[model samples]
Target chain A: MYKLSISDKAFNVLNYGFLSFVLALTFYPLIYVLSASISDPAAVSSGNMWLWPVDITFEGYRKVFENNAIWTGYRNTIFYTVLGTLLHLCILLPCAWALSRKELMAKKAILWVILFTMLFNGGLIPTYLVIKSLGMLNTVWAIVVPNVVGAWAILVARAFFQQNVPDQLVEAAKIDGASDFHIFFKMVIPLSAPIIAVMALFHAVGLWNQYFNALIYLTDQDMYPLQIILREILILQEVGGDSAAGAVGQTENLLEQAKTAELIKYAVIIVSALPLLIVYPFLQRFFVKGVLIGSVKE
Target chain B: MELSRVQVPSTVRRETRFHKIKKRFLKSWQLYVFLLPALLYFIIYHYVPMYGVQIAFKDYFVTQGVWGSPWVGFDHFLRFFDSYYFWRLLINTLLINLYQLALFPLPIILALSINELRLGVFKKWSQTITYAPHFISVVVVVGMIVAFLDPQNGLINNIIVAVGGEPIDFLTSPVWFKHIFVWSGVWQQLGWGAIIYLAALAGVNPELHEAAKVDGATRLQRIWHVNIPAILPTIIVLLILNMGNFMAIGFEKVLLMQNSLNLSSSSVIQTFVYKSGLLEGQYSFAAAIGLFDSMINIILLVTMNQLAKKTSDNSLW
Candidate 1:
């Protein structure tokens, strides 16, 4: 039923043209990186390749696999992501449910305590000291335990519960002689599937992308996450690696190192991010609903 | 509703201690059980470290632990206050945050513009493209930037040569560091950030647009009058939250982007804490700085919340 004005048609054309241009600008560099990573090291250094790859080879990936540290980083990162997400969900879901309930004694006080942390905190050093005092430093717990309950995730889940789960449902369950736990399990949680999916996706993406915690707490190179390893590789390249500074007999070739580093950076990014990216399309409906629910009051 | 059926005993008996404990536990068991995991997390991760805050007031030795570390009584704070790099870090942090504040409205504008577009497919495609980059890791994002901006053979520099201008070293320059960081962040985040605004726009009444169209109001005029006002509350709330978090820039991107040449501009509170606390083992001092930074953020949050409450009814509380 909609009709486009002549000017509107022109405008639409112009908008699409502009959008395509912007999209190309946004994506080209990423494409270039992917292509360059697979390109021959000599060709990449000589500036022969741009827009498309030249002398394509899997040598970079091969070298990256040979580095024991990269695999160690992957192992450590996956462990943290999985353990952290589970711990986060376990803490967040019940706390959010409890906070949403009005009848609980000291509910207001508890909510305030939780909200206080959201607003203010002792900074990194204080947090680190606490971890150290707990004897978690240089351990996997140090990386996973501290950030297990993100306030934003809690807030989102709470809002979802408040909006979607009617009090009547809980009351009906209670009337049927259901305990609070039974009511929550039977009535509240099943209705909150969308929000939980959104939370899981958000938390998973965050854990996968995280590097700062690992960088701070874990000192063992064997315990390093992928991002930290990538960082070391990048820094090594910037400083011309160990070989360029007249260090003798470092078996790794500089060109080969650069190629591998470049490929590994892209590959790690793809690997770390691919799960969330794939998960997002299917969860898009729920994500949009969750965001809408959370932001509606604002 | 079910609680109405319970008959209360009129006799207020001073019960036995065991009975009292049992009754209290029965009433509050669900609350305590619900709270237990979060409380455990708080104790292990939050409160236990709170004791470590004393190290900021002490000369901490790793072997001595928190209790054994001798108190220096504000010595680290004084040292930081007198340090030559204090002003540099403070100013750089404030300036970069200020730049981010200035840029905060851009995504909203983009969202509004996209919403105004009549073509659905084009708008959807545009949104998808813009939001795609946000998912890319900061490491890869920075890598893309470096490759593109490389003076020797980068696509950007190659274009510069075509235009007869010499290639500029964007990454290494201190002047360009904040711009690169903020703008790239904006580019990556604009679509994702626009989501809230789009939701707000969707909530706007269709009849208002129809009425405006009948009144001969231009598309821009209708958007300015109707759409903008509808989303104003969200805008204000988001603004308050953004201002509150102004100091807490994500350290990852900045850390990834920093080279020795640009460290002068890029070394914020977070990176400083990471280096000093974890690497150099000055846990107490780093904690002090981190505590100071968080205090500033808390002050900003409280002040902004109060201001929003006064100026408008919208507030986080």
Candidate 2:
């Protein structure tokens, strides 16, 4: 074997050093947030805690749990994620499957029409107007129905179908007297677990992280998602529900409330982001595959 | 009959092709049945909006409806072009996108560096750490920014004081708005974006690397000559895709990061559309702006695609 050059060795050292720097930069904020969430509110605000928890306490989490609106937002977000993802799959998967089939009528025309939407959409106001005209304003339907089928999702799922599900398999199943529905339900769905998982995860993460839709559509506080509530607590600084009930004593009390609010902001960030971040690494491979699949032109 | 079959006319060929289509259509009825809901969904959600975009040309009222509204031709468009915030919004939007585009080479660099790492737990760990931020919601990310940049008692400010420097309020500063928006986006999406190039790099032929090594090329040289060229097409395609979305910046994050103090820098076309249309109840005007934005995006996409086709042979089409 050829010996490594001194320059190559030096390059390797620098490369590893740069990557390590990136890793640390990305990781430090997450650890800081996690640390600050459990730290005492005053200790956190006073800059005593940076990398690790200082004066550790569960007060921030307690306040977050105590908030009625947070729980409502949590429940509403869960409902939207579940309902929206299911509807998304129901509409997207079968449509993708149908489009993937060589036998489908007007396939080119249908695909072109769908693909055109990706290049040029009606923009925000008109879509919002359509939703308004449909009388879906201020309701759950407004959140779930509008984005049930994505063109990129269709392309990704369709690519997976075309690559994995062979025409011969369907033909054999048909020859054996299996109907199209039977083949799809029994054969195609089983073979498509990986793509289905990818699609489901992507859609679920989208719905879970969705706040803009809810912000615009749903005016009612009870229908607010967790992200929306987090916005109120974190950005808007409107965490004035039951948590502020004890802020009765004047300037010092108000100061104490603001400190606690800062603490809750950290905890809220951790709490809202914890689920997806925890699940993402384990399912990271499938997510990568989904992106790769989308990038590969048919 | 035999002579006629040998010299079949175009009409007869079309009729027989129609028959073939009919037979296949009859056989695949279930496919159509399965596609019906999606078809209806597209019609209502997507196509109807395209139809409703006509209100951009009309003086739309809820009472008049989209079609019933009187046509004002180019009044709203003219009003937008002549408006004071028009240039600000246009420049801010393009500047942010151009800033993002300037950093487009970053993920490719990350992917190359990450690709150079020996396959092991350390490599995996680094990727995992970098990718975790992508999973964080925009609200939480913005929340973190707000908290970390808080003037009096933020982490960054505290650090600044530790270093004996003035505390800089990042969120409120107009100068800092675009940098904050773009950098936070880069931080969030860097690892995620690198995944595509990583995928491309994985497909680079191993033999090319061996050949480069046999020629006594250094590691960096091999990476530059072999790997970079291999992924050039992928890079071009992705760059073209990014250009295609030039005007369609992440409205959600910008909107979240926006405030009165930083409105000069943060108020993009998309956020402007949302405010004027939804919040301020100027549906017709906002639709006009939205329509203009979409038109620019389409033009950029098509133009970029054409350019890519001519130069690189890597057009999305």
Candidate 3:
């Protein structure tokens, strides 16, 4: 390696120092949330808890797990995520693969039809009206069906197929009298695992974090996703402030309710976000690959 | 057989055209079949609602349906334009978007800084930590924001009080609304946004950097000359993409952060539409506003794309 001058050495030190600051800025809140969740509620509210837990307790976690709403939301979210992602992939992959084919007839028209949705849409009310008209309001289909395919995902998958799946493979399979379905299922699907995995991960995470759709469509508490429930506990509390305690009647004493609310907010945030955060480092490469694939011009 | 070979040219052409279509269909019918479900989905969910957009011009009622509703062309739009809040909504929307657009260079700066670092555990760990927030849900992010900015006993307030200062209500005040919204968004997205730039930087030809080093350039000089120029195209493309969604300002997060206290700044077109159309059941009025918002969005996107095409060789199209 070339020898660094004193200025270059100083630059290195400054760069490292700047990056360390950025790391702390990003990690501090997350760490604070984690720390606050376990710290005694009184300690947290008294401003005694800052960087680390003080007088740690499991009270917050206990409250979160004991709440039926949290469990319901968790179960509902899992169901929606699994079902929605499966449906998303099932519809997306096949359509994207077909669009990628040069031999496919009316391909331009089909691709244009999909692409138009990206530019202009009916907006919110009309979409909600359509969902209501279909009698899908407050149903699983409302969550899983309406948003299965994105034009961006299709473009990404189509680009992947065009780049990675050699045309000669399809031609060879055709020559062997293998059907298109056979080629798609047996050959293309296996060969396109990277794209599929990336797409699935993206779709799954989207479904997991879904909030707006659930908020708009479902009114039934039983059907509410984790985000909606989280909104109720985390956001609604702030909206109503301390006065909402008497309205909900979950606890009698206003002060105790306030303390518990503060405690559970941090825990709930961790509960809702921790799974994805913990899994992120492992799947970071696929996430990077997905973004790179997306940035490639269609 | 000889007579058949001497068939009329028109007849022969017609038969061949028919046969060609049939042959093509036979070869790739499965591909069309594979595309059907997605086509159906777009038709029902997207295209159908596009058709339903006519409610913007009609007095839409649940009983009458979209077709049967009486035509009242542009009345709702007229009301929205003439309303007290029109300019405020428009300005709020534009201001928040402009604020975000102004910060677009930050991620590029970050990526450049990261690229300057030597490969090691520190660099890797910093990268990992920075990208972690992008994975957090908007609900939780906003929750954290509200919690941190809570006037009493919140972390930020705690720090202020420790320094012998008064706790400021960050969320409720209109003055702090845009700052909190934009800065928090920057915080969440900075590293994630830099990923694309980093990817672009990784593709930069290493020989250019080597040659710069041989020419006695300092590290900062090389970064300025070599790296920034290398990632210019990626930056342009991302800028155009940003312009495409200029009107869409994270409606969910805004809605979460919003209260009656900050409605003056937070009542963007989308939230307004949600309130009028869904909550208050003024479907026609809200649809008109929604339509107006989208029209402006498309116009801005096209204009920016054109501008980019003319100035740089980069355009979203």
Candidate 4:
């Protein structure tokens, strides 16, 4: 049905070539990492591993699993993500609902206050002090509480509520003697599922990958989340063959440690990321649609 | 309108206190109850910490707590302003962030170009490949960069040797630090960032393109007249938001990538604060620097928002 001129064909060819080049550039490192993680340590050291594994081994993964700290980190990370997401939704949904309604008294002032923090925060130290003062230091709550509801998520949810929940529906519900709370719970939330799912995914992935808060707040190594633990493992493994690595570890096999660290990095990434990635494809269709609905009006 | 106006004054005057309170409660109880959790969180997490910002003007001692911390007004601020590293940190932070802002739109361009492709399977494959790297953790991304740029056995060096060129120490060299950081960041983020642009592009009206085609406008002309103009608002909005955070570089990635040799170029305000506050526990000094950093961000956000409003009537406000 479509016909292209010579110049148009050339343009298309050029664009395709550029796209492919960019794709390769983006993907090459990931492939390199994956290949290196699986390759034999000796082969990896000799620079033989490239796009594929030199000697495939599950030993690296075995070593990662054998470490007691890794499992603790995983458990803590999971706990944080689940609790954080729940707290996030609990705070964000109702706030968005209230903000979406135009007739709410002091709405303008509330909005200004919320948006003010979005542009300006007291930064890390003060926030840390507040968390410390609240007696959340070294506790799971330290990681979960302060960042439970991001301003961006609130804005997105607010936009979703405003756009999707029609005033006429609420008015009709009111006329029918239904309370405002009932209308929101029964009608608005049912319609707001797609956006909620998107927000949940966003927040969950963020919490899963989060390490900075854990690093700053939790002094105990046992309380470390997966990312921080993985960082420790990675740094230790990278330098383990050298005399300097001895400071961080007394592991017998330096090569093995390096191999395990590389694999563990991949494993940590896969484990932490796989849940969201698995959930993402199913939500991908909804994502573009939801973001459009939420953002376009704003 | 006249009847309502007359009734409003009478109703206000005639209503008993009990009835007024009841009515007020009835009207707003749902909103207030619904907003409770978020309000509590804002008060506890955001607002309470906001009060702690006073520590920036004091010598905050953890033992004495925020209130009891002795006031040394403007001393920490003066220290930050007068420090030898202040200009370097400010300039480096600004330069890196500006570089990011300047180069941020390449992904959008890439998305636009990719969306325009006629090849179906190729397009799908390219998009999938491009988006895959975005999901990788920043730590892993930096690790990959280090491995590829390793002077001894890195893939890049191997390639250079194969091509008869000298191997370069990309990560350690201060000259190459910013370029590597920015380009690697771009590489990782381009596809993910392009997603919003692609979404905007999808919203473009096909009928406009058809109409332009009927008018004998070429694809380039049609894109110029139709597509670019359609996504201009989104582009402007994103640009304004990007400008708002023109100093907040990701501390984790920079921290991961930093080595002793590259410390001069890599140590931004975030890393500086992380070291001074979290690692060294100079809470007051770090708070002052952070407060100054946030002040710049606020000023930039306000200025950009105002400019966006003035020029295009599209702003965060």
Compose the digit string of candidate 4's lDDT tens values, residues A1-298: 5677677677777877887788888777766666766667556655677689888976666655666777788888889999999989888999999989887866777777777778778788988888877788999889988778866777788887887788998999988999878988899889998888888877777788777788788988778887787666653344221233355444555665665565555444455555655665556656545545556544
Query: Of the pair 1 and 3, which is ahead by DockQ?
Result: 3
| Model 1 DockQ vs. reference | 0.41
Q: What is the lDDT of residue A124 in candidate 1?
A: 79
A34, model 1: CA deviation in Å?
3.4
Sort the predicted structures by TM-score, highest score first.
2, 3, 4, 1
On the 0 to 100 scale, the lDDT of residue A211 in model 3 is: 95
For candidate 1, state the interface root-mean-square deviation in angstroms to 1 decimal. Answer: 5.1
Question: How far out, in Å, is residue A222 in model 4?
Answer: 1.8
* lDDT tens per residue, model 2, A1-298: 7677899889999999999899888999999999999998778777899889998898889888898888899999999999999999999989999999988867887887777778877788988988887889999999999888888999999998998998999999999999889999999999999999999999999999989999989998889999998888888876755655564676766666566577698888888899898888899998888888989876
Compose the digit string of candidate 3's lDDT tens values, residues A111-183.
Answer: 8888999999999999999999889999999999978889999999999999999999999999999998999
Listed in order, the DockQ scores are 0.41, 0.56, 0.56, 0.45
Which 10 successive residues of model 2 chain A have the least lDDT summed? A238-247
| Predictions in order: lDDT | 0.73, 0.88, 0.88, 0.77
**Candidate 4 per-residue lDDT over residues B1-317, each given as its tens digit:** 00101111223454596587567768869888988898777767777777788899999987888888899999999998899999888888988898888897698788788779766887776766676566656755675676668686678887787788998999888889889899988987787777778888888988998898778777677767898899888888888878887778677788878878888898899889889998899999999999998888889988998999999978987
DockQ, prediction 3 = 0.56
- List pairs with backbone clashes in candidate 4: none
What TM-score between 0 and 1 does chain B of candidate 4 receive?
Answer: 0.89
Candidate 2 residues lying further than 4 Å off, grouped into runs, are A243-259, B1-20
Candidate 4 chain A worst ten-residue window by lDDT: A235-244
Give me the displacement of residue A129 in model 3, in angstroms.
0.7
